[model samples]
Each structure stands twice: as C-alpha cells, then as structure tokens.
Target: MVALTGTMGEIPPGGTSREFGTAYFDGAEWWAVIRGKPIMARWLDPIQPLQGGKIVVDFTTDGKGLSSALVIGGYTDQPRPSTGIAQEVIPAGLATTIVFIGSDGVTYTTDRFIGSYSPGDPIYLTWDAATPTIIGKIQSQATPPPAPPPPPPPAVVTGTETLLVTASDTWGVGGWGRWAKSQNGGEYVYSGFWAGQTLTGSWFYGAPRPALQGKTITAIKFWIPAREPVGSNNAAATIHICAHTSSARPGGDVARVVGPFDVVVDPGFQGGYVNLPLTFGPTLAAGGGISIAGDPYIGFLSRLKDPQVGKLIMDWSA
Candidate 1:
C-alpha cells in the first residue's frame, strides 16, 4: 500500500517473494496490501450502509479522476475533534474506497460510512492510498429504478424474520470427545467443544444463513441447547461474537466487532441463551456470518439435541 499522498513503496531485496507495496494490521495480523481497481460502483442493500476504513484503491499509475473522494480520513481532525474542513481540502495522501464483497460475488467499494441510499447510488471504489489506508467517497450517480406503474395501494411493512441452526452446524469437533448423535439424529461433540480441546481450533457458528443470502441483518441471537450433563466451561461465560468476511479464522481484527455477550445458564439451567438483551448493536453485512469465540481464547462448549438444536435467531428485513 502506498501513502494516501501518492508515495511509492520501495522494491524488495532481489531474492524475496514480497511485492513492492505496503501492509497494515487488521487488529489480528498484518495484511499484505491489495490495491483497489478504480471502478465506479453502485450501492445495493441490506437496507444498511457503510462506514469507512482501509480503502481498496487502484494502484496503477494511470489512476485518474480520484482526488475528489478523500473527504474523511478520521485522524486529521485530531486536536479539535471534528473534521469540519475536510470536506473542502483533500488530505496529503491519496484516499480510496473501502471494500465490500457483494452477494452477487462482485466486489464493491465506497467510503467509510454511507448513509441512507436508494437502489442505485453509485459507489466510486478505490483502495490503498494512505499510511493506514484511504477511502474514496461514494456519490449518487445512477438513475433510480423506474417508479412502479402504480394504481395499486402501497404494501404495508412486516416484522423481521428469524433463522434457526438445528443440526450439523458448521462448527466441528472438540478434541476431548468424538461425535455422537442425539435422538434427533443430529451430531454434537460428546466431550466438549472448548478451547485447547481441539487441534483443529474452535469457533462455533450459530445461524443458518444460506436463506438470508441477499438480505441485510439487523440482529443476531444465539441459543446454547440444553445438555443433560453440564460440563466444564459450561457455566456462564462471556464470548465475543464477531462478524467475519474472508477465508482465515476470525482473528483479533474483524470487519465488525459485534460486541461481547454473556452465555449464562438460564433459570431452568438446562442450557442457556445469550444472557444480555440486545436492544441495539452493530449492523452486520449482507451475506456475512458471525463467529462465537472468547477473548483470551477461553473454553466454550456446544452439545445440543432436538427441541433445542443449535438455535440462532436472526432479525432482518427484505
């Protein structure tokens, strides 16, 4: 990644595999910078919008017409607290657009936080132009969809929908015990799916998201099904639920921090649901799924059966 002000990175020593570019940590590890293509994009939905971060900008020398987007880098407004003048003066480095993978499998880019927009507002996406990263601003440039040929009454809105995770969750085996099926014919870890128990690593996924492919998520709720025998690490514990986007395991750094939730024993004590009430929290990306793991990497277990399959509640709109 080059500086946002257009500084070039140095070439590596002759025999190394590293590319001539920059890298930044995503809170978990250093990421080899990938530049953005200077593509003009159109924002789509989840009915949610974007907030900015490291931009995926086109690094090609032919880059043109991009100076107009670096309105907000978040640090320049330092001492006084507000970027009151950033809207007028562009920063010293080049700022590109933040990246988001579309449900259609195409990558789209926009500035950090995009407010409310309709169907086709254009997202001018670029990446990697500053020390940390630069984000290009999104502008509304597309024609709105043709207004419905109307004589019909407008349809009323409905409440959100929920998705459940009953059996064969994407979560796999715990090191201590092998797989055993309950009466419902679903598989669960017999011993415990706690940390240090697995050589493979442990991070449990609760929601069933294949159906909510294109819809935006408003909330994520989880349930730890009842276990006849409460085991170690089974008592009330706090785990950080995170939103992950790429191939690697969810590390210290994640696209969105969904925040901490306490997994406590319910009043009945059979099993527990996430204890804290989620009146409000972060908005997750469309088509993206969350992972349940602990801070400092503690122990966690998930052994469930029917009537209480690995339950995941998701609230979202069409």
Candidate 2:
C-alpha cells in the first residue's frame, strides 16, 4: 500500500498534480511500494477486469500529505484463477507488471524495476493506480549463508616465582597496611634466581619502640643475620605486613627494598652483618612488627649495616 501526504491545493494547478511510481502484485496480495516514504491510495470501487487495452482506476484522499504515487499500469486483461485471484506468468526478462489486492483493502502491483530477481531480494510494487508501495519479500532468492565461526580466544602465561610483591607501595591491596606481632609472611617458592640461594622467612614484631609508631619500615631484624650475596649476585627481596595478627598480606613496593649486604664468604670477618634502614615514609604502626621475607643469600645488600627500622605515617583516605 501507498501513503498520502500534504494539503489539498498542495498540488500545483498546472504543474504535475502528483508523482507516482511502479507497482507489484503477489499471487494473493497487492502492494504499492515507494523508495523512501509511504504513499496513500484509496479504492473507491472494486477493480473490474478489462476485455482489451486499458482499465479505469479511481481513488481519492483529503490530499493533506501527498507523496509520489504507485500506479498499476499493465495486465488488465489477464484471466483470474478459479479462486478469483489475479494470476499471471511473469516473463523471464525485462520489467513486468504484477497486481493483486490484499484483504487490507490495499492494491499491490510489481513494477519489475530490475530485469530479474532472486529470492530474498525485495521487489517494489504499488496497487491503487497511484504510487505503489513495496509489498513484501520476494520468495525466489536463496537463503543467506550461515554466519562464520567465532575466532579463538587468547592464551594465559603463568610463572613460578613465589615472592611476588606487586609493583605498588600504597597501603591496601596495592598499598601498605598495619602489621601485627605474630604474623606469618605470605607463602612463595623460589623458581629461578638471577643469583643467591632460596630461603623463607616470616614477619615478627620487635621490642616496641615508641619512636616506631605510625612510621613505615622496609626491613625486619633477624635473630641472626644470614649470609647473602652482594652487588652482582644480589637476591631479589620483598616484604609484607599483616592486616591481622595471623595474616601476612603482601605489601606494596614501599614495603620492600633491596641493597648489598656482606656475606661470610671470608671467615676472618667474624659474623659480618648487613643492615638496611627500614626508612621510606612514616607508615608503620607502633608496636607493630616488620618482616624481611625474601631470598637472603650472601652479599645481597648494597649498603651493609645501615640498619632498617619500621616507621608509620599518615595516608590519605582510600
């Protein structure tokens, strides 16, 4: 069916009162199809079959909104089937006229714009001798091919190092937090080492020193300092503070630091020691412990005996 628009005298007097397009008709339905908008066509009377050439088609509207019309111009003398439905054998090539009226009171005709049509391709048609509307989908075209298979997903890579301290030093999951007296550092295994042996250590609280409250510490004191590599063969180290007395959460970057410590490779230096001052910011809580849990082999500290102490300071709201 077609749609009509515009006001009455809208059509210029001598100018083209209105413009219409081609039409199409399926075996059972009639439609007036246009390119962009809808055109309206009303049938004042039933369509009567013509004996020879042309047929008279009449229809009218208030002319409020007038667009192009879909005129059903050909196939007036075609015989109707026993069911009284308009029937015609559409030609193999060239534009053809196919017309039919739907139960909705709209006439549809095929203008056969392009020479031939396969199934699925839409064919334009119009009914009411006026502008024809695109009725429905053509039944001749083949169905579309199935969609392509989805692409494969990406792969995940896993490593073996256990002393995994994330790259940040803030205070929560990615930051530093409060430490408790009896805390066990996180569990990790040494996979590969640039240098030095793999050893495990946990975090324990030292005798509470008032000056240590609210300050941040990067090193913990061992009952006995262990031998470790220095400079070239230094071991990677990490530190974690427990949020709860029994829990050791991995601290951010600010929680751990590494430097050269003297190893007892030479016996002459009776119990040589390496100490790194646990000074960075004011981040540790008073009476809370410090933990130095990482690879502690010989010669790992750059600056020996500098003494690392835990300190606590203020942090902005997370």
Q: Which segments of model 1 are wrong by more than 4 Å?
A: 1-156, 166-186, 189-216, 227-235, 243-260, 266-268, 272-290, 295-304
What value does the lDDT take at residue 88 in candidate 2? 42
Error of 1 at 69 (Å): 66
Best by TM-score: 1
Q: Write the per-residue lDDT of candidate 2 for residues 1-318, one digit (tens) a residue.
A: 323334334554333333444343445444444443333443224552222323222233434443333243434344322111222425545556655343333334555333444423434344433334444444565333334466676553322211111111112222232122111322211111223323223332333444444334444332222223332334333322222121233433223333223222332222232332343122223332333333332221211232221222222111
Model 1 worst lDDT window (10 residues): 81-90
Q: For residues 82-159, could you state the per-residue lDDT of candidate 1 as single tens digits?
A: 111111222234453334333223334344433332333333332233221223324434332234364777554434
lDDT per model vs. reference: 0.35, 0.32
The superposed Cα distance between candidate 2 and the true structure at residue 72, in angstroms, equals 99
Compute each candidate's TM-score over C-alphas: 0.31, 0.18
